[model samples]
Target: MRIVVTGGMGDLGSRVVRLLVEQGHEAVPASRRTGLDLTTGAGLEAALAGADALVHCADDPSQGDFVTVYGTRRLADAAAARGVHLVHVSIVGIDDHPMAYYRRKLRAEQGIQAAGGPATVLRATQFHSLTAFFARTLTKGPVTFTVGDTAFQPVDTDFVAARLAELALGPRPTAYARATDVAGPDVLSLVEVARLVRAHRGASAPRAIRVPPVGRLMHAYAESRTVPPPGSADVGGRTFAEWLATQPARLTGR
Candidate 1:
């Protein structure tokens, strides 16, 4: 099978491409690096030619809703024209949310459904990398600012990618793949998370400041939006602690 992966150079996209190639499938990596600009539709004709299936993983930074919604519509139309199957990766709870990004994702899903092509929409929880990135970015010297009481179910990128590849090969099903309730094996407040990270690195303790709107969102997430129930079939492995343990050691710049 010839599989084309958009945003193939991205963190998740690269994993999908590698998985497909390892599975003995013809994997075409289409990204800006490969001269395939998904936002502009450049090189799409050549990139998608002869593609049996596609994993649409393209993302626009700065919350470009139009690019994500409309760009995906174009991609779906092109896939339909080529008679190729599509596997769309989206965030969990998108269908129930009114957020701009989530709304755009819903529109993308609708576009794919309207394309009249075989399609599978896989909505996954946040990635562990995203959580880690947030953790690192929110830290300032010895203080970490965070949305207090927020919950997250962050799955491993590799697991998500593998599941995507499996979905790409299997029959189309509107299935949702969630990650383990990834709260470091414990549900801790933002302050607790900051403390844990500081203790893990043997660094000085940091103060955790909870902001307002973000904290409200976090509270909502903790209430019901995030954290899957135990033994849920949709959830997969690697508790947050396990995921953190797997992270590569940091290097001090010389």
Candidate 2:
């Protein structure tokens, strides 16, 4: 099958494309890098031509609201017109949350559902890379407290890519790949995550302060979201420690 992956040049999208290619599918990566601007529907027609399915991975860094909501609508419309299947990669807990990003994702889901196209929605947890990005940015002079105690199930992006490829070839079903509430294979407070980073990087240990309210919504996520049971098929094997090991080398170009 020929699959067109929007945002194909991005970290997640690139992984999806590579996995599809490895699975013996013709994967066309369409993005601004390839002259396809999903927001305006430019260069899409030619990019999508002869494609059997579309993996909608396009994202707008500054304005996720416009891109996720409207951009998805346009893609859905085009897919319906062409009678192509769509595999939508979404974030977990989008419908239950009211965040701007999450709301836009919900809108995208609605758009795909209403388009009457063969579609599948796969919502996964945050990627380990996202956590590493936060860790790098929020740490300042030996203390990091912005993330608070909120829970996160950070998955390996490669694992997510593989699951997306599988979905692309299978029947359309709304599937949620619940990542192994993946922490360092051990439950840790926000402080601990920071401490681990400091130790790994050979930096001075930073004090981790707990902020009040710490954003209750995030707290709810931390408490409930990272509790997937043992042996669940939805869980991936890579641990947070393994993810962290790769980060320092990648960051330092070592």
Candidate 3:
């Protein structure tokens, strides 16, 4: 099978591409770097040409809806027209979330559903790297700030990439369908995350300072909206601590 992965050179997309190649599939990556610009739908038809499956991993939240929303819709429509199976990666708990990015992601999903094509939407929790970055950002020196009972079940990126590759290789649905959510094995509070991060760097655990959830976005996280309910998702991945151990002692950018 010939698979086209949008943003194929990106962190997640690259992993998916590698997995697909390992399975003996022809994997093609399409992005602006390769003359395939999703924001303007340029080179979309050419990218999808002869594509048996397409993994939608390209997204730029910083560009607002240009890439996250319209770009996704454009790709979905084109794939549907070409009778190609579209596999899209999404975030969990986007429904009813106040964050702008999450809202746009939900809109992207709706667009894919309305595209009337064979598509699969896989919603996973935050990746481990992002979770660590959050912990580092919320910690200042020896004090770690927390909002309400905010916690995370950060999934491993490798696990997500493998799943996307499997979905691309699996049977295509007649229309848009959602697969079971995926997540990490354990849920850790904000303070717990901070402690693990500090431990990884051989630093003392930061003093946790609990703060009120003052805004919609903070409140959503306080309620653990990003975490799928127990038994609601297919959880399989390295624990956050396990993943952290494999990383450099001094963490860098997300």
Candidate 4:
């Protein structure tokens, strides 16, 4: 099968491409770097010309809805016209989230459904690196400030990528359908996460300070909106600590 992965050079997309290749599939990366620009629809038709499936990992939250929403719609339409299966990765708990990027992601899902094509949307929790970044950011010297009961159930990037590859290789859906949400095996509180991060760098655990949820966004996080409900997701991935151990002591951006 010939699979085209948008943003294939990215951290996630690159992994998808590599796995697809390892599985004996023709994997082509389509991105601005490869002469394919989703925002402008440049090289889109050509990219999907002989593609049996397309994995959409290309998103630009910074560009507002132009790419995240409209760009996705354009790609969906093109894939639909070509009868190519479209696999899109989305975040968990975006149905009523207040975050702008999550809203756009939801809108992108809607667009794919509206295109009336064979598509699969896979929702996964935050990546381990992102979770670590959050832990680092919220920690101040020897203290970590967190909202009411804020916690994260971050998933492994490789795990998510492998699932995307499986979907692309499996039977094409008849229409827009959602795959089971994927997440990590354990849920850790913000403070616990901070402790793990500090310990990764041989630093002492920070004192935890819990504050009110305050505001809709913080409240949403405080309620653990990012985590899927009990028994509501397919949980399989390296634990946060396991993933952290493989990373550099000094963590960088997500």
Candidate 5:
């Protein structure tokens, strides 16, 4: 199968591409870096040409709606035209979230559902790197909080990617199906995660981090609104601590 992975060089997309190759599929990486620009519609049709499936991991968190919502609609249209199956990566708690970014993601998922094409939606919890990003950035300050009041199931990207590839390579489901939720093996407080990270990094002191719930998002997270409901999740085996052990940069707060 000739599969095209949008944002193939990105955080989660790269993992899917790697697995696709390991599984003996032709994984074509479509990204701006590779001259497949989605914004101007340049090289999009060609990149999607001859593709048996498309895994859309393309994202620009900073750009929000422009990249995620509208961009996804465009990709879906193109994929539909070419009769390519699309597998979309989404977050777990997008439907009832208060944040604009989550709203945008929800909109993107809706677009995929309404795309009138062959597609499967896979929703996963937060990635380990997202937590590490805050941890690394907050280390520069005297004290930074990991939103300890909030809780999240931070799954490994490779684990999520493995599921995506399976959906993409195996079969093309009909459009408008409910998404599947994939979460981490364990749920931990942000503070607990920070402490473990600090210990792994071998920090001299604990002056760099704190545990506090500040934003509305955090409040929702604390209430378990940011994750899937109980018994509604497929849990992976790799814990945050296990994933952290393999990442030297993340462990060291780099």
Candidate 6:
């Protein structure tokens, strides 16, 4: 399989590239670093030529319109033209979520499906690093200012990347495949997550302020609206605590 991974240098995409290569596939990293600017379609023609599949991981959540929505549509079209299979990565609850970022992700999904190509969309829950970062970042001297009651199903990026590689390398005989989801083994409260961070990082036990949800976006998280459904695929064997145990003892530098 000749796979072109957009944003292949990114955290998740880089792992995808490495695994694909280790499995005897040619993993071409298509990103700004490789002279393929997805936002403006620069260097796409040469990069995508003869590619068997495209793993769409390049996203700019801050610039959702120009970079994510429009950019993804462009990538889909190019892949369609080149007879390449397109596998799109997305979040679990973006379809009905209230956040602007989620709305954009929904648009990107819709646009890619209609953009004329063989496509598969894989929506995943929050990454462990993202959920844990709340604890990792908020633990100032003694106070960890955070939204107290929010819950998260934090999956490992390595698991997410493995699933993507499978989809990218698998057969795509149709114009579009039904979207699937993947999640972590367990869900944890924000405060519980904070405790784990404090224990591992050797940070001061935070004064832990329990601020209630204020906005629709925050409220959505509090209610577990972004978690995967009951029947969705759960691909990891390691729990959050187990994974955390193997991480570096030093706190990640903020």
lDDT by residue for model 4 (1-254), tens: 99999999999999999999999999999899889988899998789988999999998888999999999999999999989999999999999899889999999999999999999999999999999889889999999999988999999999999999999999999999999999999999989999999999999999999988878999898999999999999999899999999999899887
Please provide, for model 2 over 94-203, each residue's C-alpha lDDT reduced to its tens digit, 9 standing for 90 to 100: 65664567778888888888887778777776676665555655668787765446555567778778877887787654422222222223334455556666777787
Q: In candidate 3, what are the lDDT values of residues 45-124, reduced to their tens digit?
A: 88998999999999998999999999999999999999999999999999999999999999999999999999999999
Model 5: which residue pairs collide? none
The parts of candidate 4 lying over 4 Å away from their true place are: none
Two-way lDDT contest, 4 vs 6, winner: 4
Clash count, one per candidate: 0, 1, 0, 0, 0, 0
Which residue pairs overlap in candidate 4's backbone? Answer: none
lDDT digits (tens) for residues 1-254 of candidate 5: 99999999987889999999998889999999888766666788889989999999998878757778888999988998878899998888888788888899899888987889998888898888786665555555334454545567788888899999988887687675555699988876665666667777786434534445667776665576766777898888588888888877434322
Who is ahead in lDDT, 2 or 5? Answer: 5
CA shift of 235, model 4, Å: 0.9
When 2 and 6 are scored with TM-score, the better candidate is 6
Per-residue CA lDDT of candidate 6, range 16-94, in tens? 9999999999999988888988778999998898899999999887775987899999998998877789999999877
Model 5: residues with Cα > 4 Å off, grouped in runs: 135-148, 204-215, 249-254
The model with the greater lDDT, 2 or 3, is 3
TM-score of each: 0.80, 0.83, 0.99, 0.99, 0.88, 0.91
For lDDT, candidate 3 versus 5, the one ahead is 3
How would you order the candidates by lDDT, starting with the best?
3, 4, 6, 5, 2, 1
Worst 10 residues of 5 by lDDT: 203-212
> Which stretches of candidate 2 lie above 4 Å from their native place?
146-148, 172-188, 214-233, 249-254
Q: What is the C-alpha RMSD of each candidate to the true structure, in Å?
A: 4.1, 3.8, 0.6, 0.7, 2.7, 2.1
Native-to-model Cα distance after best TM-score fit, residue 13 in candidate 3, in Å: 0.5
CA deviation > 4 Å runs, candidate 6: 138-148, 203-208
